[model samples]
Target: MKSIDGISFKSLSSDLPAGLVVFLVALPLCLGISLASGAPLVAGVIAGIVGGIVVSLLSGSSLSVSGPAAGLTVIVLNGITKLGSFEAFQLAVVIAGLLQLTLGFLKAGIIGHYFPSSVIKGMLAAIGLTLILKQIPHFLGVDKDFFGEMEFLQFDGRNTFTEMTYAMQHVEKGALIVGIISLLIIILWDNPKLKKYAFFKFVPSALIAVLVALGLNYFFRISTPVLTIGTEHLVQLPAMDSWEKMVNQLSQPDWSAFKNVDVYILALTIAIIASLETLLSVEAVDRMDPLKRVTPTNRELKAQGIGNFISGLLGGLPMTAVIVRSSANINSGAKTKLSAFTHGILLTISVLFLSPFLNLIPLSALAAVLLVVGYKLTKPALYVNQFKLGWEQFIPFIVTIVAILFTDLLIGISIGLAVGVFFILKANYKTPYFFHKEQHHEGEVIRLQLSENVSFLNKASILLTLHHLPDNSEIIVDGSKSTFIDYDVLDAIQNFKINAHERNIRLHLKNIPEVISTNAH
Candidate 1:
């Protein structure tokens, strides 16, 4: 009762409904992420299967969902291009999975806790913005480059801004209609009146939106031949009639790529970033769970490693515990890992029987799905909240967003990390001690109240105050509340005390001990 108390988690109807919701949310994401990364569309579905089936079975998490991440879109795009081939990138993914396994064994999952919240948020916001900007062209049915292409200079000879102009000029009418209709359906389904219905509860809006998009395209083909969407503006799943045909369609990893030097570097990058994203996603899911469950971070790493290894071997993109689908799972009231497993089964079914229908779904509809995802990530509220937190949080958050937009993810994050650290040191410098002044029986009294732990950073502030003490003033340097005082700080106090007679200041110590300064010796 406590788990469900004040919580809206659904009852024991099996995880089927919850799993279906997750599947609905995941399907479009798989295709969208694949499009963004420029990887084969089937590869995203493969990663989804491995994430749902393999990860759920191996992981200790009850609510987390794993799949190809939008956060890794930029990395995949660059890795595929730099490694010379998709097969080579797949090799890098395999190595990255192995690295994750090693990290799990070494208990390096703790590294996830060290990333600054501001920087991580900035990264997510950056990815979300990138998704919207890239998807705009697709939403207008102008598919020139893939979805995750955020680089300023594009391969099509148009920069990021120029691409937008080009997209507006060459918009496809039929795809735009499908996209607008799908988006309207998704938005309208979220109305409180519609959500009260049991049917709406059982089926997710995203699924309904996609289905409507598919039907509209079919209608166009039959009744409005002039507005019919072409193959280039829709999903391309390389239709397969049988298991044998599908087997031939599966791309194999090139084992020869093991010799490439860039493979190892790319692997390291993916391993670290994927591990952080997984840890963070699971942590978030746990907070959302009314039962107050905690996922084992190290175990999650190993499970994800195994999943990625298999996905890469099968020519899938790198995967992680994705927040969007996982949040949908918990909200759908899934009580067990069966929800995740069931979703994987559904994905498998789609791959086997529904590839042609999936191919019929317009790209604009998928773009609409991702547009919502992007909006969630960069909601205007996030900006307002961060700014309210003041300069320390705002500056790094903005720096990370702009840097990632102009540069790439890795470099932008590194730069933001540096800024976050600098602000941390700056805050610490001002918090070393509390200074107070009051009139005493003897005369004007100045007190330096040491913090819980006074370190070397406090020495300069203390010495500067000591130097400015007025003549005939009574000064107190207290450390009664301090557990530890650095030797440098104590030495500064002693040196200040030694010169007190020249300024006619009376120096007193409450709990501080004398430490001879090296200057005196």
Candidate 2:
């Protein structure tokens, strides 16, 4: 029940500028994700538009943008292959949307709350690191493929690392010169003092870099060995001259596959993985929100569902609330959902009217921008900061990072979570007994104080003492300071109660609270 009316026109104006910034950032992503998802590039742009517009209108988030995500690339790839046609894949996307909508209705927005803070931070840091590692090739001007594919060994037979090595081996001076110039401009523009220069302050640095790079590549004809990202990396618009051609590209769901068990399994798989990714992104984005706003998890699911549904219908890839775009929105200083909506509008309009122009943007420039972004995410400062927190936190954080670097996202997170749990358990093992006061023996009565949290681990000590108690002795089991008692030790005490009665040993249980129901007394 949040209303957009409360956000003022002045605020909207402020947000518009930020929206424009986000739009520029999202432009390449829309195409990049589409390229990653193996869907038509136009479909990716369409999803971006829908996510920006439709999801923005329905969303509870103030600044998050909905779009096809790099994370969903695997799902989309598998979906299309299984469905047999792009049209059929579109149907699945729609179905995924409906599922997300249902999740929102269930008030599942609380899903973002449960992730451990350490793991979440690690995720963002990992993504940042990954971005930096992946963009090096692009920055080097060797763009043989579009962005978003996670495989290190790309179809080109080079992984991210190999590509970097290859680029270094046969460097293109023209692409290199343009890239250096673009990087320099961005680095200089980021300066606090120089940033305030009104003439250059508000302009998008990435766009500038791209224009400069393109001009250098086109007119100067500097023959550097570096490769340039071409139209294949950019989004291509659907030939909309005839409605029939558009329909031909649209995918439909396979009703025949509906009866297959794999369909249900795939649906569930999509639901779970998509939900986990969405929840994780939502958590990360909220952390970036300057206003300290929180989103409802269920509402997010619904918005995602709606986004997926529409994207599928149009032959686009499925979407979630992506962190890269969300972070871009936050970084751009967006004030409300209007920012997301405006970006969507820009996406739609740009694809329709600016297709040719957008196509001219060099992939290297986009890679340069991403290079900066990735550096920020995985900056050495992040590691230093986490290390200062203590070894307990730092160890898991580093483990997660290394795991992500060597393996994939899910595996790395899993390992980090495991290590974190191990640390907790190890800490617990150091303290086995509590409430310590030595046993006291008066003329006739022996008094023993019970320890706090007398767990099974401590049972051996207490039980051994009980068995050695002198015959005909009067004993008092004092638990006056005990806060909690474990069940295994309780069983031992109850047995002591029985044995004491038979031994003609008078035993008194102090702190005479009736034995608390089923637990240790």
Candidate 3:
């Protein structure tokens, strides 16, 4: 039951069903992201296949999934226009993959460790809220917007807040019925009593909801033609009827554009941004892992590099480790990489032979699925827990969620990180050295114990403590635990030594280095 790579086949039962759920979630997202990025519709599916198959094979993460992401859509949109053609942009993508591989070798993925836990949780919560807000249009039967976008601002000039009201006013009758029923099915399937049945165990609630939605719409078509939810709001995939036709759609890169300096610049920009997004997604996914396994990040960069490289060669968009699909996989009971691999296989089969059946499923049904996923990620309990953790953790977490709501993911995380660092510095400033008074036979002795590393930031606190010391008291300055002391702090202690003579204060230095202080005449 165990593979040579140590993955257990015993979990296939759970992984296979989880894979079906992910395929359902990823199918529309792949198409929607392509539509948003201005790439060929097939291109997104190609990237998803590569991310699920090739990246899953090479990555150390057991559950994380990768694919064409909305985060990189703007970059691709501008990259294509700047380069003058999609072929030239494809060449840039290949170079970006090489750059990411270099980053893996250089161990640049260690940057993921620096982000605070509060910021990571905030990022997850923001994505959840964005998912709920963004799906409202689709749930109401409006399919004007693209998918996989977490940003508040929409490409169609509507913001996330306003889109809900617009969708409510323009709701489609048939699509609304399917969506409401699908939501109910998913909610009911999640009930503990229903889960006790073997049928619910083998058939995921998401897949069941999609199937029921398809059936409902079909019945409406046959029984009452007036209320039929037609093809307009259904899943749309570019036609690929023949093998020759599919082969023609796979684009080739323009190697002739290699000499241009802008090509290299674009490659570098994509490499840096994609790598950062991948790292952040991997970290968040790791936090959600039920077994609490740590993924090797550098290895993940290499896997993503390979996925992007393959995608570029076949005329696909850039990719990063995506959080939504990964979270869906986890919530569906996935235990290993087999689930992602299975989804890749399913995508290949479905696209090749079942496009007609797929095109029948309504967007409203898929939106309901995402609605539940979003609720779990941004649950009310998360806010209550963060609030209980107090201001230092709560402030950064709240700031990250609010900032991401208005700006974008990367910018919001940066703002939260700045706040987290500020708190670290403030804590260091206040408690750089521990000051205590001890009763002694030879009058009261005051001991100042410097922390392990006393930097320039700690100098102000040390100086204030030295200045406020009672006149003519015995003081012991301890540096035994310090590995390094800043010259500024050492000088303050040395200068204070000068004033000790006037006050007749007995100064005892323990492992404190002597620093010459210039006498101010």
Q: Which 10-residue window in model 3 sums to the lowest lDDT? A: 1-10
Q: How many clashing pairs in candidate 3?
A: 0
Sorted by lDDT, highest first, which candidate order results?
A: 3, 1, 2
Model 1 Cα lDDT, one tens digit per residue, 363-404: 788777767767777889999999999999999999989887
Candidate 3 off by > 4 Å: 4-6, 440-444, 453-464, 467-473, 484-508, 513-521
Q: What is the lDDT for 255 in model 1? A: 88
Candidate 2: worst-modelled 10 consecutive residues by lDDT = 429-438
Ranking by TM-score: 3, 1, 2
Clashes of each: 1, 22, 0
lDDT of each: 0.81, 0.69, 0.88
Q: In lDDT terms, which candidate is top?
A: 3
lDDT of 2 by residue, 1-521 (tens): 34453244556644676677677767777776776667777788778888898888877777677787776676777876776666666655666677767777777767667656677788778888777777676666666666655454566767767777886775555566677888887777767787677655566566577778778666643553234334554334444444464457555555556555555555656666676777888787778777778877777788778777777667677777777777666765677888888889888777556666766666666667767766766678878898898887888888877777666676777787787766655544444433233444644666777766556666676777777787777877777767876666667777687668677777788873454334334
Q: Please tell me which model should have the higher TM-score, number 2 or number 3.
A: 3
lDDT winner, 1 or 2: 1
Stretches of candidate 2 off by over 4 Å are: 1-9, 12-14, 197-201, 221-249, 252-257, 426-521
TM-score against truth, every candidate: 0.81, 0.80, 0.94
